[model samples]
Each structure stands twice: as structure tokens, then as C-alpha cells.
Target: MNHALQLPRLEKTIPLSVVPSRLAAANAAVARFLIQAGAVREGDIPQAWDDALQVCERALDAWVKRELGALHCFRPYFSLAAVDEAGGYPSASCKEPVRYHKVDICWGECREQQWAVGDALEALERQQAGCGAAVLDVLREKSRFVYPLFTPDLACDVVSYVYWCGEENEEVALDMECGDNEDEREAMREEMVTRKKLDESFPAWVIATPRKRRLSRRALARLAQDASDPLARDIAADVLALATLRIEDEFRPDVDGEYIGFGAVLSWREDDLTVRIYDDLLQMAHQSEFCDRMGELEIAIDAPQAMRGWQSAMRVRFKTIRLLDRLIDRLSAGN
Candidate 1:
């Protein structure tokens, strides 16, 4: 996969110091990056959000391109750091002709495409130097625009991303606000389509657990419903309570624009109990925002470690599959 891009001569030039928290570090770093970029006055910050944002918008122009690159999603992210050296950073700019240097700073994932990357790296750098307020700034913007309830800042591994959402300190709600019944249905259908594509790519497996290999006719109907798409999530949950196996998976299917949609493949595992868990999906867990394909499987949490191991294996397999597919496709196309 192509790596994320960078502009020449961009460097961070700030002295290291202790700060109260991540927020303070971010505030300070934004001040420094802005001052070097010749974007704002140092005194403008440590104030209300609006005044501080003016300084941010100016500097954001110089680095905004890095935020939109789609590659950051499929490939692992590396550091896009500011340069530092023994005893001192390259140069300090108390004035114009702002100093430049090179360094590496790793950033977290952002939906695998069109990352809202501006906040995390900024927060990280500033926190190391003693400020992370800009993290909050970017977060406020996200809460206003995207998933409102979930902070979307907390970084997690593939498994964690599916099980949980939100950042430090309590739950944040994602505002997938439903306007009316029609909108909700459409959203559900969209998610279902995404899940279907995911199953095609990763392909959910049905494991035979250590249970009686028999299920009710209702059980069969439920799996068929979840396996396809839920007509009602509530019913899905109720049916899930009867499941024995577990299903673990996620699909990064998304739309880039009005006419542009793309999908990121998924992989997951459930030990010795695929049929029981698959039965859960047949019911309705797919309807809720937090639960999908395997929501019912989780209710059988008398078995998390086995599920986790299976999920991990699945992730490895999916990643390998994606890489191999890309390589084969490239070789065939001779690109």
C-alpha cells in the first residue's frame, strides 16, 4: 500500500518541559506550530475555545493534505514527527523565517479512510512538551459533526474497536441521530449492505460447538434474518439470548463522498461454537449501533478468552488476505 504523504521542510521546534496534562501540552504545541508557521500570536491561546481556534485555522492550512490521504486506513500508520536532537531541537523561531526540522510522530487510526488526524498527533506532540488542549479542540469539532456520543479519540486494537467506543473518563454518545423511521431504516440497510460485503470479504465461519446439533425452527428463522439483515434489532437481541456459540467481526465499509463508497474487509473468529453464535446473528443484534454480526454471541460471555483468541486469529488472517489479494491484483495488472 502507498504510505501517507508529507511536505518537505516541516519540523517541530519547541523546548521540552513539564505540563499539567495532555490538554496543556496540546495548547502549547499548537502555539508553537502556529508561531513557527507564522500563523498566530502566542498570547492568543490559554483562553476560550473560539479565540484559540483562530490561531489553529491558520496553521491547519499548511498540513491539511496529510489528513485526507486514504492510505492511512489500510496500511499501518508510522510517525510523522518533528525533528529533535541531542540537547536541543534544530532551531527555534521567536520570529519569522520560522525554523524547520524533521522528526517522526505516530498517529492513531481514523476510520481507515479520510482520517480526522489533525487532533491526535497534535495532542501527542503537545502532551510530550506539556500541552494537549488542541486535542479537546478537535474533539469538540468532531462531536459537533460526526459521531457525537462517542469521543472517537480513544485508540484501540481491532478487537477493542468493535467491543467498545469512547475515550477517557466515562461514555461519550455517538450522534447517529435518526430523524424519522425512514432514515433509520435506510441507515440499517446501509449497514447491512456493508456487513454483507464484509462477509464476502472476510466470510463469517460457522463453527460446530459442543452442544446438541439441534435448533428450533424459530432459531433457524432468526439466523436467516440476522445473517441477512434485521427487520427489528429488538427481536434480534431477544433471539440472541438463546445462542451457544460466538461470532466476532467488523466491516469498515464506508462512503467517501456522495457517489463514492468503499469497503475495508473484516475477519473474526469464534472457538468451537460457530453455529450457536451464528444463530445469534440470525436473530437481531445487527440492528443496534454497538452490536453487529455477533452481538448475540457476546451474551454467552461465559467464554470471552476463547472468543478473543479466535478473533485475533481472524484479524491476522484478514490482514494477510488483504495483503495477498493486493499483491495478486497488482501482479496481474502489472502495476
Candidate 2:
């Protein structure tokens, strides 16, 4: 007999029996918020809300399958549920129905619950009535479930490249200046040759330099063309493409002249891990400190800023590359 089967079974804190009602309540809250905010007309609230809910649910399902594939036993039971006063403590104001909840591992004995949804009613009631930040935050969080900034495979490739570059040439400094004049260019050719020597040894030396510099799309394109190794060239090309899409699609500046980005927190409890993704750029900047402890690679993108013409001030922190690689490896192994 398998000893694992003999062990006490872990039951879900929030059972699946209450999931439908919770989801309905949460969706209703979201619908009401949208209608009140004029995002959707009161007449079109039902269809619009249902469509949005379906989109979020589908994205959540895909994210769970991709990220938690190794935990096969928990995959089927994990679901998006709303937190009520009974199942879990509701938000501060109990006068209204709860508008906050997140994806729960419904089959396990996990106690920790993440805040995946925002309190729409509270935002309207307490804060500025027109402030739709909470609604946008919820949508952004769900969207990130489907579209992570860096996928596990891409992150691993980047880490490998950075490691290879660092290992190949420890003596070569990456502080060379580019010259605009022809004479200056000729003078720097020897330095360029030295840099090329470093690149020749390890072609994947595009990012993670000691000095901070914004990576312009033009620079990335140039690097892609100059890369000697096919793999390095492809990686540089991929980065350039991703950077372009990210700036164009996601990293738009808000009315406050600040760019918005998603932040994620990974917590491990025994063999199970939970990932909480939120739309808090300030928190992301605060979390950059983790890069020092947990090996990190920062990529600066020259994105557009409100009022400002253009700024290469966007920084993305990939601190969980190793952990993500382990998860990916376990998933690949059919665990």
C-alpha cells in the first residue's frame, strides 16, 4: 500500500459547494461598479459583466494549469471564489456584500488567501467617485494571469545567457561609451574589438550590466544584428520584440505621469506555493531589494512617459527565475 494514500487527507478550507454563490455575488458587485462608473450601461450590465467574468475565468484557468501543473492533485480543485464573512473575513465594511476574493486551492488544507479582486463599492463610496483604479487593478491582475511579463522558459534562457557572459570574461568591463563622430568611432574600434572578444566568448551579453542604462529598441536591434551566436542573436531579437510590444501595449503612462506595471509575490508553504500578482508599480519598486538576495536581472526599457517625450525609466525585476525554472522543470518531467 502507498504510504502517501494512508496519510490524513487535506480538505479544502473553502469547499466547492459554496463556489457558485460566491462567484455570482462577486460578479454582481463588479457589474454594479461598471454600470455606476459608466463603463457599461445599466441595460447592458448583465451581458457585459458575464463576458468580462468569462474572460477572467478563462485566463485564471490557463494560469493555474501552466503554473501549478506539477501539483496535479490540486489542479482540478483550484478555483476563483469570493470571500464572505463565513468562509473568510470580508472586507472592512460588512454593510455591503464582499467584493474581494481570489483563486483558492479548494482541495487542500491551505489557510492563506490572496487578495485577487478589488473592492469596487468601497472605492466608489469612500474615495473619489470617478476613480476607477480599483476596477483597473482587478482587470490588470487577471490579465497578468494570462500574460506574464517573462515566461519561465524565457527567464531561464536569460539567466543562462547572463551566467555565460559573466563566466566567460570576468576582467572585461561593460562601461564602454559609444561615439557619434567618425574619428571617435575609429579611436574606439580597439575598445570595440576588446568588447567583441568578450562577446565572441559568450554572445549573450546584452543585459545585466554593472552600470545602469536604458535599453533602447534601436540599441537592441543593433545588438541583434551584431551578435555572433545564432542563439544570442535570436534571444536579442526576442527581447527587442517583447520590449516593443510591452511598451506599446502595456506600459502606458497614467494621468499622473507614472507608468503602471504588475507586481507578484511568491510564498512557499511546505510543498505548495502561492503566487499573488497585483497592479501596484510602487510595490514593485519596493520589491526590487529582493534582487540583491535572490539573483535578479533588471531590464530597462525606453518607454513613453506622459508630458515627457520619452524616457528609458521602466525597470522590470525578474527575481524568481531560479524558482520558476524549477517549477518548469517539474512540470516538464510530468510531475
Candidate 3:
């Protein structure tokens, strides 16, 4: 990855006492952007702001764990505005030099991570390229654009935005939206074809779609059973069994809700299958197998907040179906 495109590492530390105020400012800016874009009603700002704050808090917690520090501040370098284009609803666009810094107090220094609007646009393009232009183009038309100020890892990071495209919608709706019934069907057909191709190419690959309900054991079993390849099937079954046992033994029932995070991947060669579960898609690129297969899988969750639960459960529901593509290539060559 280009150094400019990669997320910045922490370099300095900010005072903990200033975090709450900084977060408030960041929330206010996001709320303003959403309202101006006509994405949110004035009456909804209060509740939306509260929800945004919660998401920031959750993300901050994750950052703390990874960086061993707390959030320092959010420095806004650019602002989001609604731009009216010919023959369309006002679209949100970022002004030039559009960027923001997410500062965290790590190792006694106030380190800052920057995500520019350009970076977001580039990331979106990469996502569309990976997942299929048709699928994302349809989603983009109907969905509100949300630019994450920080590096997003889990579903919560994506869902933290205050505004959604539709009125009173809680999450980023993945349901294919089209003008007519025929168009909808055509879109679905195209998506199904794309999915089928992905499956045939990478038997272990899985795509995580938005879900409305909790995941059940039966659903997981079905997923395991759905794998046509012996190795893929075995890996799926093993992941299911291990995830179930871990949840049962290490934690109580997930009263919060279902597991609806981003995605997971299981990579194996020959007799040995390795299970690696992750919510961050960008980090997957660091893996040797995924390095060359750019745009093969969606890199970010573009919808609403996903339900919180066992991270492993997400693996069962939306398994990584493409990680083995390169591995298979190498095996064929006896490399």
C-alpha cells in the first residue's frame, strides 16, 4: 500500500481531559453535515447525535486496546457540504484539502491518524472495483455517503455516522433498490451471478450481508453444510464448532443482539486449515494471500451499525470465500 494511502500511526499524545469536548465537537460537525445534506431532520439531530457519540466511544475503546491509549481529539481540516447536481438530490461533497485527524494518546505522544476525503473516495472506488461496480453503483445511488474520520475496523465504525440515506432508517440498507420490479430482479440476478463466480473461484470465500435477526446454530450448520469442497466444508465445520464451544465456555448468552460484523476468512493448504476471524477488511491486505488480489472482496461496511455479539459468529455467517484463490494457484504450480 502507498504510504499516503495507509492509515497514519500514532506519534503524539493528547490530554485525556480534552477528549470529551473534542468528541462533542466532532459529533456536532457530523450532525451538521447530515442535516445539510437533507439526510437527517432537525428534530432527529438529538437522538442521532447521541447514537453517533456511542459509536465514537466504542471505536475509541477499540483504539485504546490496540494503541494502549485513549482518544485525544478530532481535528477537522475539512467540512462536508451538500452539493446540488443537475437532475439529482443534493449529494454530499468534501471541499479541497478535505481531511481530518483522529488523535490518540499512545506511548506518551499525541499521535494523529489522518483520513482525507480523497482517501475516502479512493477507498470507495477500490471497494466498488473489488465487489463489482454494478452492486456498489446501485447501492451508492440510493444510500447516503458516509466518510469515516478514523480507520474503521468493525461494523460499529461504519455505523457510527449520524445520517442514513432513507428517512428513519437505522442502518445502511443492503437491499437492492431499483426503479422497477424488473430492474430489481435484474440487479439481483447480476449479484447472484457474481456471487456464484466468487464461490466457484474461491470455495472458502464468504461475503457478509446485512442481517435483521440474530444468528442461530442451525444457520451456522447450514453454512458448514453448504461448502461443496471437502476442505472448505471441514474448515467451516471446525470454525462453527470452535466458535460455539468458545462462546459457550467463555461467555454468557449475547443479550446485546446478533453477530452482524463485517467479514471473516479461513485460509488453508493441503491437510491443515487455519481459522482467522477479523472485522477489519483493510488489514486483510496485509496477509500474503490477499496482497495481490486487490478489490477481490469488499473493503469496508457501507451500511448502518451492525448488531454486537460474538466476533466468531460473524465468521460462520459471512465466511471469507476468496483467501484461498492465491493458495490454489500456488498449489497448481507446485510452488
Candidate 4:
């Protein structure tokens, strides 16, 4: 007699449940197993995960559109003055003095839930298969459903997809834009020049940022160990997996002296450590010890008091802050 609990495969044709997300489908399978085993009851999936998924879906929908595909919106840093002069300012609060964009991509949040889902899936799969248990044999076929989601390959794939999406969007935006008059045409030409410069600046900002000076493998190891929250520690590993980065500085030609933009470009690294997730940038970014040190470096890139002249150095500093902010925000959210 077969005693193992048989579970239903995810339905692939229903309108509401047909296209289950990778994380969601994996999580739902695990959640069902736990319920069957009396490990946990229904209504346990936190509302926060629901909220984060909603936001991620919206961003995905925006990027999927042909017209919007060329517009890079992931943690974008742009000069408010320049946008306003071009009649593209989305809001007044999105104005100057904010060097880094204050938007949330929900990456950390979604990732945390996915990791939790992965842990649950692994545990449940082990139990169901009777691995390390007294049972001699069982169906091993179901084990493959517990795929490793947190590996470097998956991480790099997702990040690359995001970058490609941005590039596609930017290309479409540039090609579709047209000027109505000579003055408008001149403005368009200048904007195009500025955009191109910003594009070139991304890679330099990633490699040359002052944050690279303070970062070390050993330091990340210690920070991960010392972090109070488990999620914070896991996020540390996520940031470390990022192999490359790019930042661009944005300025306002109309305002003459306004420095109001920055951007992020990222890819995966394939070194020895890339195969093994280890480094932690969030804890280091949040450390008070490095804050003043990085602050001093920031002054060198900026004009000491004013917010203009955000060179490559400044772009690096701001991106670090943005990553730190993202981690902190994710850690603070309800589970």
C-alpha cells in the first residue's frame, strides 16, 4: 500500500491560477504539504508577501509594454530640473537635492519571501520522500520539484533580464521621441547628448565608486555574522552576488547648475565566490563606522555644500546608499 501523501500538480490552464509565478508556485506547493502534515494551518502566508507581489507585478506589467519597455525605471536617478524643463517631471516631490531615486523596486522584499519559500520546499520535500527516515523506499520522482532557486545562475539571469528590459525601453524611447519645432529640436538634441553621456557613465560608476574601496570579502563575512536580523544577513549575500554595476550622473542644462540624477546598472560575476553566495554589502553600508568615511569621500565628489557636479565618484557613493536603503526597508517590513 502506498502511504506517502500524493499532491496535485500545479494547474496550467486556469485563468486565475494558470500562470503561477516561480516563487509563488514553489511556495504554494510547500504550503500545501505543510498543511497536510499539520505543520501549519491555512492563512499563514503573510499579507506583506501579498503586497510585495502586487508591486512586483505592476512593475513587470509596465516593463512589458512596447512603448514603456525602453524606459529604465528600476531605481532610476534623474535630474528633476532637466525632466521638468522637458515637461516630463512626474511630481514636485521628485525634485532636486535627492541625488538617488527614492523608489522601491521591491527586490529585497520579494527575494526574502522567495528564500523562505525555498527553505520550506526543501524541508517538506525531504520529509515527504522519507530521506534520512526509517522508510526504506519511496517515489524519488517528486524530488526534482524542489529546484534550487537561490543559486547564482538564477540570480544572474534575473538581473540580466532587468538590464536588458531597461536597454530595450531606452532604445524605444529615443527612437519614438520627436521635436515639433527648431527650438524643440535643439532641446531634443541636447537631451539626447545628455542621455548618451549618462549611459556611458554607468559602468564607470559601478567599478570606480568609493564604496569599492571599503568593501572586502572578509569584512562582508563578519557583517553577515553580526547582523541581528536573519533576513538582513541573507540580503547581504544577495548584494554580494552582483558581479557588475553601472551608475550615471544626471544634470539640468536648463537650470544651469543643478545636479539631480543617478542610475543603477548591474550584472552577475562568475568568479569562485559567484558559485557560492558569501559577501554582504547591506550590513557594511549600514555600519556607522563606514558612514562618516564614505561621507568624507562624498564631499570630494560633490561641491561640498551644493548638490551639483555629481561626478563618477558621487554616482558610486549614491548607489551604495540606495542599496543600503533598500535592504533596511526590506528588513523593516512585516513578514
TM-score per model over all chains: 0.17, 0.24, 0.18, 0.19
Candidate 3 lDDT over 1-335, as tens digits, reads 65666785643442222324444455444444333333343333333233343344344334223322222222112111211222222212423221222211111112222211222222322432222222122222211111111211122223323122332232232243543466665655454323233233221211233312223446446645774545434433443443343112222112232222211121222211111112223343344333211111111111112112222233322121112222122212222
Candidate whose TM-score is highest: 2
User: What TM-score does structure 3 among the candidates reach?
Assistant: 0.18
CA RMSD (A), model 4: 27.4
lDDT of 2 at 70: 48
lDDT of 2 by residue, 127-212 (tens): 32212222222222322422232221122233322323433332222323433555655555544323343333221312224212
By the lDDT metric, which is better: model 2 or model 3? Answer: 2
> What are the per-model C-alpha RMSD values against the true structure?
23.3, 20.6, 21.2, 27.4
- Clash count, candidate 1: 32
Weakest 10 consecutive residues, lDDT, candidate 3? 292-301
Over the full model, what C-alpha lDDT does candidate 1 score relative to the true structure?
A: 0.29
Candidate 2: the clashing residue pairs are none
Name the weakest run of 10 consecutive residues (lDDT summed) in model 1: 292-301
lDDT of 1 by residue, 85-133 (tens): 2322332322223222322222222232222322322333332221122
lDDT of each: 0.29, 0.31, 0.28, 0.29
Number of clashing pairs per prediction, in order? 32, 0, 17, 7
Top-lDDT structure, candidate number: 2
